[model samples]
Target: MYNLRRFILKHHFVILFILLEVISILLLARSQNFHRNRLVSGTNVVVGNIHEMGSDVGGYFHLRQANKQLAEENALLRKQISVVTDTATNTYTLLDHDTIYEYIPARVVNNSTGMANNYIVINKGKVDGIKRDMGVISSEGIVGVVTDVSLHYASVMSLLHSKSFVGVRFKNSQQLASLRWNTGNYRFGMVEDIPTHVELHKGDTVLTSSYSFIFPEDMMVGTVEDPSVSSTDALNKAEIRFATNFATLRHVYVIHNLHKPELDSLKANFLDK
Candidate 1:
């Protein structure tokens, strides 16, 4: 108690001066309309800044949730669009007929585009009706083919894989070609078996062919980047800029064809012969 009293006595003047200054400022602010308004305005400014900062911090934390929600919405829209497009193109098919293809939305858990045989793993598998050889696609375009499936996960052979080949055709000229990764580039793939007679252009769209049972017909694969005649007189080769950026892939849809079993069975019997 004695030490406390001595400390207070030593700084008494400074403490009194601070108290008096605070009281004077309060009195002045209350007595003068301009000062009162300025004080309120300054307080409001500080509070508003604090509120904005808090909101920004909260929003930053919610970004991943927002993105996942957006991806789910997009997956639904894509399924609807694919169904509508297919219906419009079908001539003999009934309007009320069951859809030939179904899309199962999934998140990519792991991905690699740099390897010679790049593969992707998604957070859906046998339990989600994902099967081996099912086609995978992103919102932009074709992604890959499912090769293995567990109850809760699936592995995909990405288009960037050296062994990957997709049947594709030019949208403008309808010239059929095969797309294959050469392990030389990530953004581009090689379109092979393009007929020499077909007029080649730099920007022609390459799309999935109807012959592919794995992918829906007319799905985008890529756009031609460069075209050149191959050493063989029969064929030409072109570089294609991939429609889907595998490096940025986050969500994908697995395509299940209802008629795939029948087709596979027929192929198997034919192959046995």
Candidate 2:
């Protein structure tokens, strides 16, 4: 206590000077209109910057929620376009105007592309109306099909799988073919069952065929890669670059066919018919 008193007595002048300087600044700011305005403006700027920083941090944390909302909106828009169109007239003929496919937005929880039979796992399952045989796709293109389902998760057979078979048609010619991955490449696939005389053009896009009940018609699947630049062609078969990038697969949508039950039941008895 005695040392503290001695120290204060020794440095009281400095402390006093600091206090007086603060008081002088405050007085000058309060009395002078210019100084006061400057001070208020400075304070407002500081406050605004702090608020902006806080808002940026908050937005960063809510990105997932925002993405989910966007996915939902995209799904709704897709449903609105589920119509039968006349290619000759460029017009849609609404016979019943009934939506056939219902889209459920989901996120990829797990994915594999470096294997012969790759698969993808999504963050939704039976609880989210996901079921086996349901088609999966992304905004870019067709992804895969659901194979297994749990309460909160589901597994998908991606196009990279050796057994993957998807009915696809050339966007321009509407020539039907079956898409498969046999070259063990995730970026490219093979379209089989196409006639040997049929020539595939470079950059020609292939979309889901109406023949498949699993996927809606006209869903993008892949594009025919330039054969001259590709060395992975099988038996001179043209290589197709997949629309969906499996390595960076993330958000996806599960396709639920509204008339799947009736369509599938009838399809099941096709041999009998």
Candidate 3:
């Protein structure tokens, strides 16, 4: 205790001076409005920065959930958009205003694009009203036509199939052609039988023709990537690029036209008679 007292006595002068200085600084800040305002503002800025940093860290942890929600929402919007566009384009000749086409939404269970005869399988079938010869489409464009149907699953002949043939017509010029895929690349195909005289341009929209009983008229098929007239003859050909990427197909819709049966019956009866 005597040693502590001696030490305090030795340093009391300096300690007192430090205490007085701290008091003086406090008095100066309290009396000076500008200094007090500056101090408060500086402290608030530091605290705000700290709170922002904490919030950023918390938000980082929630990103995965937010991203998944966004993806699901985007997928739903794409589905709605596809339906509207298909309805607007393909409802060209609905004689029966009562006719209603039903679309059964399905997810792609299996798909193949690297092979010569590619196919796709969906998670829906007869129970879901998905029948054979129904047209299947993705958000971007046509995917294929249903070829086989089971109780709960259906197989589709993808546009990437070697023997796949689709009736397509140019949007502006109304030039009809046949779209076929013979290569492994699902991004593009060839449109044949477009006359050399037909006016065509790059990026022209190609849609389904009404000649087929399977798909409704004017369903989007692809876009013209390059149009070239045959050098040897008067014929013309177009290289079409499909909008739907077969390799990335996830969701699709199976379209069943309500007027197909009546139309087929009339045509069959006429041919027979």
Q: What is the C-alpha RMSD of each candidate to the true structure, in Å?
A: 21.6, 21.2, 26.4
Residue-level lDDT tens digits of model 1 in 1-273 = 999899889999998999999998987556343122323322233443453455456556657965885787679889998887888785645453477998899877667788776777677767789888999998788999987666666777889877788999999998888999993678999999977778888888999999999999999898889876355647888898999888767767899999999999999999999
Greater lDDT among 1 and 3 belongs to 1
How would you encode candidate 3's per-residue C-alpha lDDT over 102-132 as one tens digit per residue? 7788866667788877767676767788877
TM-scores of the candidates in the order shown: 0.67, 0.64, 0.64
Cα deviation at 142, candidate 2, in Å, is 0.5
Ranking by TM-score: 1, 3, 2
User: Which residue runs of candidate 3 sit more than 4 Å off their true CA positions?
Assistant: 1-97, 229-233
Highest TM-score scorer? 1
Task: Give RMSD (Å) of candidate 2 vs. truth.
Answer: 21.2
Whole-model Cα lDDT of every candidate shown, in order? 0.79, 0.75, 0.75
Q: Which regions of candidate 1 fall more than 4 Å away from where they truly are?
A: 1-97, 229-233
In TM-score terms, candidate 1 sits at 0.67
Error of 2 at 14 (Å): 87
State the weakest 10-residue window (summed lDDT) of model 1.
Answer: 34-43
Model 2 stretches with alpha carbons more than 4 Å out: 1-97, 227-236
